[model samples]
Target: MLREQGSAIRNTLDSVLSLSNQKAYPVWESVNSFALIKAAEAGLGITILPENLLLDSLLHKKLRLIELDGIDMENKMLAILHKDKNITQPLKIILDNISNVL
Candidate 1:
């Protein structure tokens, strides 16, 4: 499968693979989504991508959309901070609200 490396999605996929005890030997890996999609459409291999990214490509009769059962397709946003930084109650509340929406 084609994997977009160095992404949160890839990290999530790695977690899923670890939990499932499955290993993937990808023939292609890159950060370019367009190239990855093209490769998939060209029959290179399967790739996991957000539905919103597949809108135009799905219109092609030759391309098929396959859902990954039990997998969340939503993009997860992560916030990182320094170790010395303290999260105040207001900041925590705001972060919690934002996280809940995601």
Candidate 2:
């Protein structure tokens, strides 16, 4: 979840509440890379983490991480420009080249 603190907490709570009705489980919180590794080492909970976070040494043998498609946000690196500036020929060519890859 690409959410700020409060929203992340709410989402985690909702997941915990839903799981509670079916089985006994532990609920965790939204945490940065270091905190999450510590939580896992303490045997407190599991989390949905991105692949990039696992490169840290704390994550090694500490977290039981999994990958899920369609669970993460899709971010596009866009170039925002003012409409008033008339795009020069060189700029137009560059934009066209970027669009091709996208």
The C-alpha TM-scores of every prediction are 0.64, 0.37
lDDT of 1 by residue, 7-95 (tens): 76676677777787986567878787788889888988888766656778898754689877886645557888888999999989998
For each candidate, the alpha-carbon lDDT, in order, equals 0.75, 0.55
Error (Å) of candidate 2 at residue 19 is: 18
Query: Which ten-residue region of model 1 has the weakest summed lDDT?
Result: 1-10
Q: Candidate 2's residue-wise lDDT over 1-102, tens digit each?
A: 222344443355445545546422335444454576566567765644444555553356655556554344333458889989899999999999988755
How big is the positional error of residue 85 in model 1, measured in Å on the Cα after superposition? 17
Model 1 scores a C-alpha lDDT of 0.75
Top candidate, metric lDDT: 1
Top-TM-score candidate index: 1
